[model samples]
Target: MSTAGTMLVIGATGTTGSRTTARLAAAGHRVKAASRRAAPVAGAEPVAFDWHDPATHAAALDGVDRVYLIPPLGDSDPAATMLPFLRKARDAGVHRAVLLSSSAIPEGGPAVGAVHQALPGLFGQWAVLRPSWFMQNFTGAHAHARSIRDEGIIRTATGSGRVAFVDAEDIAAVAVRALTDEQAPNTDLVLTGPEALSHDDIAALITEVTGRPVAHHHLSYEQMRDRLAQQLSAEFAAMLAGMDRAIAEGAEDRVTETVQRLTGRPPGTFRALLEREMPVLPSDPAVR
Candidate 1:
């Protein structure tokens, strides 16, 4: 007998993907948490899944009625890289596919948005999560977090511009709904925090929440690029610094109500997110 709605979560170990996996399983859905490593998850089946390999696609799609598309890393165009996988998912009986995309990158960009473009023709249903820069970027072992904790300074080309900085957990909540429910709007969901806050505001928030003397350290676009180049490739450094430049230009300084509409509750406030995640961040005062 075929399961009517077997949900498959791609990139099951990632931040949002892992949360979605747990949420779906808790709902009593038969979830197949797929990954290249197939890490174990309670109340769900772990299956082998690799975006680059076509031969293993069918194995992951077995009994999968819906899919959460988290594309492989690197700069390759996902529209092309993951198309065959999407096609195979459809052929193997997957109905809907929810894609994780970026808020900074506009629709039809060279990467995730490409998957956003291709999924409609390749599947029965689709939804794209166009979320802003994550709050987790500051709370996790990434550039933002390291800079704040180690240097007591945050460097960015984004001058004093604000961003809505949505939380990945919120993104997962929206994704879980789109995957299991029938009423998800078949379009992009621009998930954001309840309000936008400048990088200065962010530094202030941390100082207030943690009672630490943190500060926003701003730099010119060229200077920021040069500063980051020492840590990453010139090309990669430029790409990341360019995003800061965009934010400086007011590209991502706004709020939206989509999170509430889609997930049926207000998106987590930046303060709320900080409160929940503060205890988890490493206590070392010097980690830059």
Candidate 2:
């Protein structure tokens, strides 16, 4: 957890990764931004690193004592690839490790959960960030954003269930603290925004802020799964649909103060994020 050593940020071009990299670099912390293409990131050195490619692991680990891990996306079982790399990282002298997981998944539950379960054993200074659904899903290139832009509709199987959609910036701020703080969190943190909102509420906010008409289209679990299967594996699609069903059952209904407690500031709200990132709809366009 030495501040002198470099921090490696995997998925540097991604939602929270990019922001985490920026925050670390801006704070004068040494950072290595890791992406599959070794794409350049501002304020940090960029290196090519893929979870599936063990060959790229050594170079990325060089001079790196801390790591911000974004598990390989779309893989139902990330522990299969992640555990091996983690062991290699430990052998390479890395100290602190912070993993990005989801609120929907818990330690030893599924997907990144297995990695979460093994983190404390791998590194003394380790934290698992389980953030709720991201607010960026409506402003960025996510399916909701794309659908909102092209069709003015938000489709989901999540009925009236509300989620405290957190902002990536807030998540990054907490991550920077976890990485550089004298003491690591050393425990799993569930991060969420200030308020829990449903899809209909989100669509209304977007419409209110952007002056554009947007509607939420509710779909059955089967319909959502089938629709998502067109773009994702059948298993992944089913899992996603199942998450929506879970949401419908009020699983993601509560809010937490993790962001505020860690970052010394209250987490931003969804409406605030929308106003800042998208005050107006795109004339023609495009999270974990």
Candidate 3:
């Protein structure tokens, strides 16, 4: 609350993590940005870190009282890799922790769930961010974005399911508040954009914004799983497709005011986000 000590941000180069670190640093907060490579983050100290390697933990935690927890990517169960460092952070007197989780994976559900369950007992102050599907998934290096850019198609197993896709910047803003606020929310926050729309709606929006045709191709769960398995393990691929199946069942079709309540502003809409980010899509014919 008083904002006295350095804040350690794991996954500092990642989507929300980068934004969080930059925001914290711009606010004049001392920050340690930890990633696998030691690269400078604007207004913050950068350090090399890896979840699997415990040896890189302490240096990052040194002199830090708060942390931003971004779980290991591509790991089905990340708790096994993350808990040990968290335990050490607790012992080292880190008092506040903000974990970046997903709306699809509820607290105590699957990947980062175990870490979410263990947070309350480990630290005096903590918040778990369960953000809906990120809006950036359609514009950034995400698989969907590549498909949209090259093939003019967005593919998923979520049939007609709608999602209130949130923005990474909004999530970072909330995480900054959780780390620095005089009174932490002290509970898991479910963050979303102001509206819910299906993938078809997103494709339509993109088409309108970019003046290029875009389509959402619905795939069977098994088809999606098989497609994903070409790049990922079978188990992880099935898990990802299963999340889409749950969305198709109407799991992620809700909006929340948590972003507004936390950041004193409304969350960014999918259309607005597309207008802002779509220009960055490759204009080069070779990219298509």
Candidate 4:
């Protein structure tokens, strides 16, 4: 499916949004990169946008016909803030929307799920990308990766249950399709990587790749909650621990071909991701 029009990408400098913005621009579509700060993406118009502040919404939606939605972070229920801008976008002639959702959160579940439920009625063309835990969580600017770099340990409450961690690049590829395709899939797409592996397996792979010892520590739900509560609200902390509990219960163990089905290419594997983001060796030979 092929259609061309200006597309707005929220969370413009973020992991998936940056990739989607570059992809759309490279494909010859006009793009509006929206963020709370100026995110001047090459070949795209940059606009300051914040979901909590309705005043920033209109300028971002000015000439866009399609949008890639990344709901406000840290807010348990962003629907209270997001719904109004979405309505405004529709009234301003935006016809399609692609939302970044999670595989753990089903439609009508907590967080972005509320907006996922409301999208269908708001636009004739829309797609909800429900992606699995990101492979980048093990290598990028995530807490798990930070611990790995600093202490050589990956900590989580997920005991032995496996997760099919999809690559953020694959998610972005799917989003491009959802935004530019002539017809939206018009349903929630459950996206996953090619295989499922436990956190221990991920640690082992990192050790193998970096030639440095890495370990996975399994924490109880309560322990994990307490740890996260030090940095986040009690409610949000509990919700995160609960998701880990669900993972331990075998909720995120399956793989899906939705990425390949949409993009005509297999999603990258965890090892491939690791290879691409090779761990940096210390400058001093003694540290290495």
Candidate 5:
């Protein structure tokens, strides 16, 4: 709403958080970019913030009337830390809050769902953004991206399942509107890309666009979970594998207009994203 009080953005160094902070600052709104190191972010002030450390909460909340919340990464029960900080935030005069959530997780479902459930009651003006899988997963430092780069393979338990992978920039746009609009969405919004694509479709698209040999390797749920366990907690690995299984069951096999409706522009396509982020080989005649 009014650009009087500052906006506090947690996880300011993250995908959507960084973009949100930059957009806010570019629009001339005051922003406090919160990260563990309190690293400087362009166009915003840096502040140290840790979800588990309540001592970092008050300082981040000071002079902040609105907040963009990015829950602790890999925390299965984020509500434990987030709820407490949220209560403290409300007490410290924060009125509007926008929470980042996932499309697979419904309100009160599990993981960040618990925080989503508590948000409405905590702030009079609030919005919960439930976005689908990010398109950047295949281009950035995500495991999928690593595998694609190293082995030219994308492994997953989701066999033939499709996802409407939205862009992090689109999610950030929606977050900005939710945080700055006079009237918050006041409801959970499920954001998705314009089309639903299976992992096989993604692999083919990457191969064609980048002129690289890429393939999707289907794995059993147990296989995927055990592989992920090497890098993540057993519980978290299981949860991620379960999500893949759900995708295989057609849980995420749909697209939505949420991004366009909120941002007044179309969501980005996977092909477009790949072309923009990946270099096309000179040997590929399609682009040459």
Candidate 6:
């Protein structure tokens, strides 16, 4: 079997973390997943832990050698809350840490970037997964059903701005490799799809595949921010606005071979992902 000392995974129930946990467990590593909920996993131990609750942190850190770190949800100062837990991980003998970050957030700007600044001195091995906007966010989250049923619109500040949007599955695949196979990629990787497409391009793709007319609704940054403020915390609402502003400014329009370099295969194209998810989207009378 395979073992890499002991790997403790935070956010194991989340999108990338869940897949990474399964991959690590399948590789025969001694893996335990930490989350706020105490759900049983097939091949690993699930410990009840919360980023907000420091009391349960150490027990989860017990006997761990490497860690898969995920920053908590909105409103926590990553430097303050996450750094202490990272210090505890080091104290518990963890020498490697893999952090899941965003490409939208620059390496030293906010969120996981702050943790990136602090990891090298604390751990012997480390990599940060800086993935572009997730395709799953459109399909799995609050937007999917709404987008389909109404064939309404995807409102954004990214007007005609092309983004090489990537899949969470692809991100997970790369993260697994980073966690297991490679030397610390010790740098920010701008993960993206093979081709960059504008919001209208995405709408066109949906129209082609599903035969449904979905529109790209462009909004000014402040308008989107004000609308988001009604739904999210001030900080989180601001983050979305910031990311959209980045998209507007052409920060996410990258196309890279990093995925192929790391995984020995090309990143899945947006068309491929869209076709796979075509069933989940609404039907068009023209196609039907």
lDDT of 5 by residue, 1-288 (tens): 555479999999998999999999998899999999999999999999999899998899999999999999988889998998999999999999999999999999888999999998999999999999999999988999988877788999999999999989999999999998878899999999999999999999998998877889999999999999998899889999999999999999999888899889999998889989887744423321
Q: Write the per-residue lDDT of candidate 1 for residues 1-288, one digit (tens) a residue.
A: 123388899999887889999988888888988888888988889998888877778878888888888878654456777877788778888878899888887677756767787767776678988899999887887788887777767888999888999999899999988887765458888889989999999988887786666788789999998987897777767877888999999999888898898777888988988888865343345532
Tens-digit per-residue lDDT, 1-288, candidate 2? 344589999999999999999989888998999999999999999999999989999999998999999999999899999999999999999989999999999899888989999999999999999999999999998999998877889999999999999999999999998899999899999999999999999999998898778889999999999999999999999999999999999999999989988888999988889889986854333210
The alpha-carbon RMSD values of the candidates against the true structure, listed in the order shown, are 3.0, 3.0, 2.0, 1.9, 2.8, 2.7
Task: For residues 167-194, write the lDDT of model 6, one tens digit per residue.
Answer: 7778878877767664667766778878
Look at candidate 4 and tell me the lDDT of residue 166. Answer: 95
- Compute each candidate's TM-score over C-alphas: 0.90, 0.96, 0.96, 0.96, 0.96, 0.91
Count backbone overlaps in model 4.
0
Which lDDT values do the candidates have, in the order given? 0.82, 0.92, 0.90, 0.91, 0.92, 0.77
Candidate 2 vs. true structure, TM-score: 0.96
| Winner by lDDT between candidate 6 and candidate 3 | 3
How displaced is residue 98 in candidate 4, in Å?
0.4
Please give the lDDT score at residue 81 for candidate 6: 83
lDDT of 3 by residue, 141-232 (tens): 99998998788889999999999999999999999999999877789999999999999899888877887778899999999999999999
Stretches of candidate 1 exceeding 4 Å from the true structure = 1-4, 226-236, 280-288
Q: Residue-pair clashes per candidate, as listed?
A: 1, 0, 0, 0, 0, 0
Worst 10 residues of 5 by lDDT: 279-288
Worst ten-residue run, lDDT, model 3? 279-288
Task: Tell how far residue 1 is off in model 4, in angstroms.
Answer: 3.9
Q: Candidate 6: minimum summed lDDT over ten consecutive residues — where?
A: 279-288
Query: Which sections of candidate 6 miss by over 4 Å?
Result: 1-3, 142-151, 280-288
Candidate 4 runs further than 4 Å off: 280-288
When sorted by lDDT, best at the front, the candidate numbers are 2, 5, 4, 3, 1, 6
